[model samples]
Target: MQENKKTIYSWALYDWANSAYATTVIAGFFPLFFKSYYSADVAATTSTAHLGFASSISSLVIVLIAPLLGSIADVYSLKKRYLFLFSYLGILMSAMLSLVGAGEWQAALFIYILGNIGFMGSNIFYDGLLQSVSTKKSVDFVSGLGFSLGYLGGGVLFSINVWMFQDFEFFGFEDQATAIKASFISVALWWALFSIPLLLFVKEDKSTHISTTTKLKDGYLRLKKTFSKIRQLRHLSLFLVAYWLYIDGVDTIIRMAVDYGMALGFDSSNLILALLLVQFVGFPATLLFTKISEIMGTKGAIYLAIAIYLFIIMWAATMMEVWEFYMLAIMIALVQGGIQSLSRSYYSRMIPEGYSAEFFGFYNFIGKFAAIFGPLLIALVALVSQNSRVSIASISILFIIGAILLYFVDEKKGEKELKDALT
Candidate 1:
């Protein structure tokens, strides 16, 4: 039991490890730095387009390859190795960001895109390890533990980084630019240092080694098999569809919130503060949300979260005050980690053992694709109505439809259906 406890803590530490990238780089400093420092010569809109394209391209690459990689990892028992490789790639790229020169937006974008790929791609295998680390009874708590840790970990480093950027002189930095670049190196080191515990302690299910060529061939074959099998997995397929829709709303809110705040004319520093609020609030809230899940059941907890998000979206449409934005951020923090962690654990219940990686490949694929539509939906709405509020509120439809579909996703039915279909 103690060994299992150690393994679980080790596994969860990766979330703590990589989340600094999410907070400091993806959500915090990079965009501001890109606009002011890297692409100072270009028009603001032009730099925005470049950053958007880089994000889309990196996401597209992950969407295309996640499933195949999962299949290969499953067949070859390579989840840990793959996780290490991608994490190393991310860590290296993050550190390299410090080396890019001013007015070199192209090089900065290239490195940032690679870093995004590394951070996002490694999650596929890290998620695959979920099943190996915890039993069914403990999965929800365990999953929530990871996200809670992520919030705390990401928030801690980001707070320090923010201080460094805001007061570069205190840190003996030459300037804020130097401070921001130094933060990148800090994220890389934090990611690398925390990742060591997982590599050293956590283990995956063992399988026999085979030639690389044969492994590749078998991987493709396995992926093909999963494709045919997935169609017949009625309830599981239904859950994935529901997850795709609702998570679309969730992810869109997460990715676009700061932009939405700017559109409402709030100060950038206030937006940053709101983000910090989410991180700190999310830490304890996720654990509380997990407890709520235990009482309400996973699906029930998810439904409650969806209901809250729907309300948040509606509130956002009419909210005109910076304080209102902060309130919305707090509300989102309460449910965000809970929903994500629960969805991951809930999906784990329906997939067969030994095939966790490939199935989670599809899981990650669906998740990555979820980010695309809500953004498009917002852009389309904004284009038609010329109102950011209307664009933001339009996301409610995704959650409404997702909740309706989720009503029919019976976990027992999914497992039974998968079993019969496989036989």
Candidate 2:
């Protein structure tokens, strides 16, 4: 029992550790820094296009690799090692961002890709740890706890960086760009420092004891078999497809919202504060959703989240005042982490534990693929309409469509199938 508690805490700490990178580098400062510093010599639209393309390309690579790596980890029992490897990769790449300066678009793109590879790749293995760490009854709460801690940690570091950016001269930085670059250094330090507890305490599952050569062969075969089995599990397959669509929209929103704010004439300070609000808001809101799930069940909680997202997208589309953005931020705070945490738990509950990693690979695969459509769609709409607001508003259709499909999924039936697989 003590070991279990230690494992749970370690898993949660990893979430806290990596979220600094997600919040500061991915969501907060990097996009602004990329546009302002790297694209100072380029047109605004061109810069936006470049950033969008860079993200799309990196996501494309992750989509291709995640499932296979997931399958391999499941077969080989190397999930922990892989997690550490990718974590270091991401941390090092993020730290290197301190080197980016004016007229460094190509260099920025290069490091961003490496950093994202580390981010996305590490998550595949991190998620694979879920089944090994907790039982079915506790999974949702623990998952929510991890996400909540992540938000808290990321928010704290981001708040510090916000202060640093506000007072750049004290650091002897010439401008906000240099100070913002320093924020990347903080992200690296915070992530590395916080990850230590998890690395020390969490033990990898050793149940899968296949020989190395056999493991490699079996992993490939298993990948092929999963494709066929996925077809047989029609409800699970459909849910994944539906999740892929809506989650893409959610991810796109989180990734692009700050950039959209910048484009919409929101002051940098306001944008940073709003993002910080999301971080803080996500911490408790995620736990609330987990409790709500106990009464309403996972599917119901997801439906609630989808409803909230629909409202947010529409609100964003029509928002005329800066205060409206704050309202939208509150709405996101209410749903974002909860939705993601529930989604992971829901899917885990449906899969057999032995194959959790492989199924999660498919989960990661669908998630990465889902990321492609919303951003591409946003870019396409922005290019055609020359309006970021319209592009932003266009994302609402994903949630609406996803919700409609989710209504057809019978959770009772899914539960029965999962039980049968275990027995």
Candidate 3:
């Protein structure tokens, strides 16, 4: 699994590929488009509710199957092949989004939900590839670099879309809505094109135990073993619980922020600008986090990031001014990518190399299920109180619980156990 530098860089290119959807569709245009166009007939809270529902549904779908898929992948040596399949599915769905005309919220919602599945499904395999991309000592740096590049790449595309949306006539588009749809196509194309390097270059180590029977049987056997082994893996189990809680808040903020701003009566342009600020700032800050992790240690650095998130959530509760939103974005920019990247590297370090795909599948499955609660909570709060602010504020409790549980994880002990298990 020790790969060359070329393999590592090619692997990182997938981040550049997929992040277009992260920035443009998720953060930049889709929220505003959903509110102002497709759901124009509904109240802002209702649109936000629908968006939350879509996110929750997508997460549920992945939650049901990610671990099983991961097990099958580990047994069948299907990681790279499946990554491409999911990536293409996502790309096609993203491209199809360009066809949704005005007042087609239902169509847009369905397509977006499917596309999200593809995006998240592909990422599970992508994260599993970390073991193949770099040595243990370099994993933190490599992981940080991937996220940093994603920010840069997604930001570049989003900035272009922002210009096109801002100057629709200059781009020779009939309207801003059309310009935004064009951006969806661009995101899809960029994803498909850049994914070529990884597809062509980066490769997985072949599975040692090839299944003689059907994949379902093979996967079931592996999955059964994984479940039985789970109880013995104390630190990994504790970390997943902590991750579910904290990442619930983290992902809630990512998925709901633009929508939150929209319901707050913020201008779409201002919100997009805030999104851009996070992208540009997050790029360098992610690298800085790699350095910080080296100095403070992974768990320490993660705790520091979580503490800052606590302050950020508290600040989010009272933010009313556009300037305050901008400030909040800056704070998030500092920790967002770092926490995510470091979490990936730290988890990779603790898992048995042979079971990486299956373990990471469980990891991502937990993440997806954890995502369901935050959005549901936010949507219900918004529905009941008819105020986006209240729902947004409630996310802080997840971070609080997560940080507390994270303290119980013994990293060295966990790594030793996983290594011993592999032996």
- Top candidate on lDDT is 3
Write down the lDDT of every candidate, Cα atoms only: 0.87, 0.84, 0.88
**Worst lDDT window (10 residues) for model 2?**
414-423
Which should have the higher lDDT, number 1 or number 2?
1
User: lDDT value for candidate 3?
Assistant: 0.88
lDDT (tens digit, per residue) of candidate 2 on 1-423: 123888898888889999999999988898888877877787665666677777777788888877777788877777887888988999999989999778889999899988988988888888888887888888898889899999999999999899889988887888888888889988888888988887787776564766778766777787887776677765787788889988988999888888888778888788888899999988999999998988898989999999989888888987877888888998998999989999999888887766777788889889988877777887777777888888898888888888888888775677676555445
Model 3, 1-423: lDDT tens digits are 656778888998899889999889877788889988878898888888899999899999989888988888887778887788889889999899899878899999999999999999999899888888888888998899899999988988889989999999999999999999999999999999999999888877665565446787888888887777776888888898999999999899998899988777788889999999999999999999999998999999999999999898888877888898899999999999999999888888888777878999999999999888888889999999887778888888898899888899987888887666656
Per-residue lDDT of candidate 1, residues 57-111 (tens digit)? 6777888999999999998889999998999999999999999989999999999
Tell me the lDDT of candidate 2: 0.84
The best candidate by TM-score is 3
**Cα displacement (Å) at residue 57, model 2:** 1.5
Candidates in order, TM-scores: namely 0.94, 0.95, 0.97
lDDT of 2 at 286: 93
Error of 2 at 416 (Å): 4.3
